[model samples]
Target: MTPALDIAHSVSGQPWHWRGGVIDGLSGSFQPDDLVTGLLLSRGCARDEIDAYRTPTIRSFMPDPSIFRDMDQAAERIVAAIRAQEKVTIFGDYDVDGATSAALLIRLLRGLGLDAGYYIPDRLMEGYGPSGEALVKLAEQGSSLIVTVDCGAQAFEALQQAKDAGVDVIVVDHHKCAAELPVAHSLVNPNRLDEEDGAAHGHLAAVGVAFLLGAAIVRRLRDTGYFDSRAEPKLIELLDIVALGTVADVAALHGLNRAFVAQGLKVMAAQRNIGINALLEASRLDRAPIASDLGFRLGPRINAGGRVGKSDLGVRLLTTEDPEEAKAIAAELEHFNEERRAIEAAVTEQALELGKGQDNRSVALVSGKGWHPGVIGIVASRLKEKLHRPAIVIALDADGIGKGSGRSVAGADLGSAVLAAKDTGLLMAGGGHPMAAGLTVAEDKIDALAEFLDARMADDVTRARGERALQLDAVVAPGGVTPALVEALEEGGPYGMGWPAPRIATGPVRVIKADIVGTDHVRAIVAGEDGRSLKTIAFRAADTPVGQAMLSAGTTRKLWVAGRAKIDDWGPRPAAELHLEDAAWAD
Candidate 1:
């Protein structure tokens, strides 16, 4: 029932437990820790259906779009716009998910010989989500039908204004919604109050929902023989955009989402999209991109556009056709990403200092005047990671108004708490998913808002913090760590926010070499009793207990290294290396 060596406590003082894995009934064809079986058990794969999950496909996981309440209405309206040649616009949020969702619709409409424009509100200027003023303005500009992607879920007033202005709107979003729906012609959201079968997919990102809508539109158009004269646009080709948006939004990678990313990576590797190709080059990615690359590399650059530069730049890049224009946009986004780092660093430093003085509160609420509104979300994320609890960072403007973004730990539903605060008239406006949220508040109400959130969510935060655990997938020996094993682990991917990459413990190894790398990284080569050795690297942990122990321990001492397996291509031949997260000395 217990591990051979107790690595229950990490250097940060969290207990680690092996995930719910069974060594028996594994078909007796492989070891308990074999890549395939480990992945299957970690994800709770059924014995008979293991093969199906091994290679997820849209055909296997795609649900009927009409299962959603307003899917048919939304699809039919879109088709009508295509037939009437009416001007349509896609209204989107400012993050990666919104940008990609807008781009998906624009591109889909374009392929059908329809000219579609897009509107992405400025992060600092417009705050978040669709506004009634912006919607009415678009209607005045001749857009008969407007589709809001990744937003409009909580735009009760904005949607009502748009409806009153005589403009038809379709909402394709996946944010959490209240019981009373927004006033729109059709709202295609899984989180809708009356949702039935579609509610099972409540975890989808806005782009994923948009992609479902795209499927419905294509199907309806096909039934009407709209594609007989013109070639049917291959919706599969757009999965690359879907993959990027889904991963960047931190959507759970289960069921259909895993299929999307798994197949989308293939589409991305084809280098078909000029914009994506340009972005890859800008990121210095010479090889094919993977799922993690979406979150760590491409997502950041796309987000940088909304964070520190022009908000529309991301959508423009994703929907562009000109190679030169793509390159220009990609380079601009790259520059913004660099700028974002500097701004985020400054804001994070200030927020951490403020957080240190608020240890008495369940949630860390830090605010500063003149902070960049664009970087508040990133700063909040950093604070949550460092503090291991709910965090809210606010950027106060000169006119006594503050725009705040918040992130929460797993068991804490900060989104619901924020919504509750907004309902109590404590916040001017606020909405978000369970783990993340955004709000606008009067400067003077900052303390009141903090107290309201803490009081409302105190018990939940405490329970969540108490249940946090480090889950390991399997165990391996030093000799078992090889490039072959690393490649085999791919069957369990594309790992992300909800669907984590597997972590393994390779133990009873003596440290042959350990040293500090560039900046604050710890690098070491550990060997087992069989004399098999492998390299490991702990990033940004040179001063931490784990890194210090690795560097200072004598060669005679043995330890278990815990981390994810990575393919190391630094040598002529590929090797497996561990991105070390934690290590414990062997008893």
Candidate 2:
């Protein structure tokens, strides 16, 4: 609880705190030298669960699929369809999570010898969720059963239309739900208002829920002796996609989600999934991907299809059997990702300029008439990061209809606020989880919506920002920051979202040299009192206070540099470098 290194504030104006409280060598079950144990404890893992956290396994973290509401019914319906060889289509959102969920089910069904079709709604034409027209069209096309993944939780009218048209809709999603549910035959979401025991897994991404459904379907088939002759589909093989969707969606990495990623990475390494392997090659990643690669490299490429190119490309790439087709899709997605980055950069610049005018408001709500709707979510995320507040970027069309995407800071429930606004008639359509949300609104109501959110979330934003501090897992001198330490800390990984990588503070060092490298990155070499020099880079911070401080420090001023220690394998011999996040003046 005490301030780390006796400093009340860092250069970024935030205090640094030891994540696990001050570690006393003799008091706790773990010794001070056991960095992994300390990291596990700081991340809310119990002392008795150290071994489990160290090696997260599906068997240890996964819950029985039957624990969720409607699990048995959904599985029974799917098994029946499998037995009947009936036509079925998976209706998914046009995002990474949706693509992966659809791909997982399609692949699972393929292994069962029942081919299923898929539909991903165009982001620009059909919007975020399933529309009544699309659902009915799929039914009219001879599909008897439809499964909507990553969406449909809020598609009240769409689901009703499907029901009226004699189509059974099974909704497997992870979004927060309203008390009055939609008219789906089965709605399985851990965040359901009526969820009892399954609510413990509210942090699952939609792909994770689909993975559970996969397990449930397999179990039902096993119970019916359907797999006695044919081998049961190895559901574990699908964890690679599950991991991709889970990390790409920024779901909390703990428990089952953690196990999904940890094991998924291994499955990914096997190169069994032709589509994933092609994507890896397209991304120029020659080695097996870690958790960060999913979020940054692979996830973005898949999302680029939904954001800028053909919406179904991701699903097509993931579910394709032909390696050549997979390679072509991956290449196309890479091109789209590059285009997406350009559009996002332009939108972000304009949004940031507009955000400066809203400093008095709790939320950075910005809208532009000509802004591309596809890139608003990424722009909103960028705004949230820079402004240190909840942000919503709305793209208004000529008809005065606005499509908005929002990203929230920690402890601020932007999704709930958006949902409340919809309930109060401020939003025409809206739904999301705690961290991110999407909405449709009349452009005229933008101001009122902003006002409503400002009033509703002001206190939460204030408290969350007020309590913000740079959390440090360990503090060591520059000499102690080595490849060995970085490797040791990795034992606590595949870290992300709720479960973060260990942040090490190594300081009492003077900057030996500093320069701006790659656009907006501050790269520096610093040496401590022990005369040991190390490299540090602060990405996209050349214009920020931390970057400015590091650049101007020169060789005279001693400072504490805090960041995630990573192994720099680019050199002839592996060495350690700091992906610096924050720094403080030590003298």
Candidate 3:
């Protein structure tokens, strides 16, 4: 049945919408009395699946590794290398996903009595994927077997070159693949067009795919009696790395991916990996990291290595066993992160200025002659968020060739649009997922590319913007929001990306006090009809209607505050605070 969309006019003048899911099999078998279970039911979880979701064990959600196409082949090749003691090399992307994928395999192989080397393509000098020259060079350096992670899915020419050079290469990637496959020893990707059971897990990041490959390798070795004399490495311990990579890559946290993060957090909290521990210390996070910490803190430091510093730093940091070396690498990454932030800020300012002038265009296209290529992606993301449309930020080099990165708004397939541009000869090279993409283009063709995107993607962009709606989970009184409630809601979590944190609306509250806090945040305290007052903060919303309305609201005005409930431990007692997202007046 088509459910009616409940819509409300928020104080920000944007339409707030909620579409409640019918509790499947709710024949009065079990009734949820708490916020957590109610949140689960609202998000489409069946009563039977609640227990599994609450715990989210990999054993419960993990699919058999053999379900993927070429899984057997990929596993067999790795096992052969381990048996023969052949030198193996890992080629990984510079991003966190690639770094962790390489680190995971290197750690696994090292445990099995093989030392594997790794290579990361420089974002500036080498660009995105493996190059034919790099592959041939690695083969020349005595790497008998090479595995490419988070990349090589689009390396048709490079893979062919590797094959011609007599190097056996296995591709473990999650990027969108073309109809024509790359020539590799075995290409293992759930996103492959012809994949069956694996195709359902297309949302997996490359690191998730690597973990699956790890499982396959272990299973194959176990069957061959390779572990008869040796103690099997505990594969579960590596979930910490898996969790970091998966969350950093912004993979949707649902199904298997959620299980990975949920279990991975438990593994991470143990501080088993020296490098991870060092990173925690460097980031000033004394406690165990949450899902948001992976994305904001540690993830950015690792990404800083790829963006502005040495591309190999991330893999080195992740693989290092020496605590001192790990600490040094973490510190270096911290420095790089600072540099990246400065660079990103400058580029974002320029990109925003250029993007603001592009109000008439459906997609913002901003390019500069000397903007650093490393920071363009971040700038694109900022522009996309501000413009509420797809945004492309291009960095033009001396030869008039430009490297561009783009971010897409929800419901827009910017990556597909970029791919179409490549196919139309407007781009030199381009590919990505729906939300993000990268491309190379001639400086002179920027205008043509912009025109092409505007004309071709106009309808999609418009439809996407019009369909935007905020989904709220439940409504609760101010007194109902408590530390216990927040703790309970977390059971269904490790929430991120597609699996969002539950947002609740608390209504019939009068503003007790409101003021601007920090540079651009609105902070307020409101008293509900129950005379319970709660603190609320709306980040980066000072100038927006939501913030302005809250900040200037009269004491007599009663409003409903909608946002995620979070645990704030600033005081002696841990209390639940509302991270205000939106609000509406109530009678």
Candidate 4:
């Protein structure tokens, strides 16, 4: 709804891109509050221009997974292994992917009444993946088939150890594959070298692949009589877990992942699982589930266990059938998550200081002594988003062994960069997708690793930055705020990494109310000339770039706002609110 001008307003000099897109297809106009959000729906199916925004689905395949090579084979092998009712152990990572993968596999196994046990390496002790110690032990415990969920692509030595101990290992992973994959009974990884599938799907976190494995396994079980004695465990039931792992682990939310998330949210809203329900209740989420709720609320709590507490925290919480046991583990994770936030704040400050001076080269490599290895990945991602550059955050131990995680910008090749560092013998072990990866470097070699990465990634960084542009959607006067607009976005969502929630642009408004909310958040209201306005809150902005921008802005300058519309029920009266982003003053 375009507002008629009652009085003369600020003259627009340089016009911005309307950042517009088709809305519900029938109405080709870009509504002001529906800019970035409309683009997300239009980018996908035409039919979804309306409903998908409210309920996004992976079932609709916008993301072409043909880019990944081994997805099909990896999916197929998992089916074959699961149908036989052979003893299985899911070896997963300590973080989100590993936790989700283990959860997915263990759930499937338990549903089928098969021997299923999950093993997550202790972050403080055993390191990552299936270690020699765990592998040998699994062999001794009479495990016939060992299915490594997230971490097996890097376990070359341990797989051989398992094989020698008379154990057949099946690796269902999504990581940078080595020249020689572990000599497992069968390695099912989208990142495997010899595969013929597409690379686009390789963006899936291990949990996503494990979901595919779950799908294939259920199919194979049907071909046999696995369900003859009992109804087969519904693969759809696992989608909730799949979606949780996929979104929480920050995988691309395109293609099947879209379906996973879209469907998963529905399942999650039903709160079928005792563990998921406990997690939701412990997190204090009032309304039903949304994709962001999983990322902001649930994912972090699950990861808290591995980051600062015991690695088994997530595994136990997800797998325990007992309500009291699940509640206990979930509660512990909630406490750990609180502690993790404090640790992250301190670690991020130290990293920012260390990264202050570096210039020109694309990657930001920050090393800190005695940092927690479990939380390195999130810190790397934070640094990358802050500087708009690739970043590798390393945690160095007293023993001079540095464990690190990396987050990459859109254009930079992070997987290759990690590989190059490893090639030069600076890293002990490391690999990942372009957007995110993990590795371990010797403490003394941190400088050499950073320098090595700069050389390899400098050109790509420059190329990526040179293509600067902003696609702003519809322009709206401050008078157009309404509850109806927020409701419309629901039909277009189920958003994730590849697909983002829409952001509306508005301007010619003055700051009405602005205050800091959480540990690092700013809450403010921007009012237009017509006495109409929107509420906005920015998270993690306290003492940061965005926080300072909102807190210190004077009322004299008219500022434009871009953010999502949310319904805040905090106070007795419920009303709509705005989440602030970038702003520019009207000249």
Highest-TM-score candidate: 2
Which candidate order results from sorting by TM-score in descending order? 2, 1, 3, 4
lDDT of 1 at 246: 94
Q: Give me the candidate number with maximum lDDT.
A: 2
Q: TM-score of predicted model 2?
A: 0.97
> Which regions of candidate 4 fall more than 4 Å away from where they truly are?
1-86, 198-200, 542-549
TM-score of structure candidate 4: 0.89
Q: Which stretches of candidate 1 lie over 4 Å from their true place?
A: 1-3, 22-34, 510-519, 529-532, 554-557, 569-573
Model 1: how far is 583 from its true place, Å? 2.3
**Looking at model 4, which ten-residue stretch has the lowest summed lDDT?**
5-14
How many residue pairs clash in all the candidates, one count each?
0, 0, 0, 34
Candidate 2 C-alpha lDDT tens digits along 432-466: 98899999999889999999999999999999999
Candidate 1 lDDT over 1-587, as tens digits, reads 22354566766677777776632211213343365766776777777766667888889899999999999999999999999999999999999999999999999999988989999999988879999999999999999999999999899999999989999999998887888888999999998878999999988999999999999999999999998999999999999999999999999898899889988999999987889999999998877888989998999999999988999999999999999999999999999999999898888889988998877788999999989998998899978877889999999999989999999988888888998888999999988888899999999999999999889889998898888877777677777767666666766788887778878778778999999987578999999877889899988678678798889777887887788888885778778899988787775
For model 3, residues 364-452, the per-residue Cα lDDT tens digits are 99999889998898899888877878999999999999999998877788877887888789988888887788899999899999999
Order candidates by lDDT, high to low: 2, 1, 3, 4
Q: Which pairs of residues collide in candidate 1?
A: none
Error of 3 at 250 (Å): 1.0
Better of 3 and 4 by lDDT: 3
Task: Quantify all predictions' global Cα lDDT against the true fold.
Answer: 0.87, 0.91, 0.86, 0.73
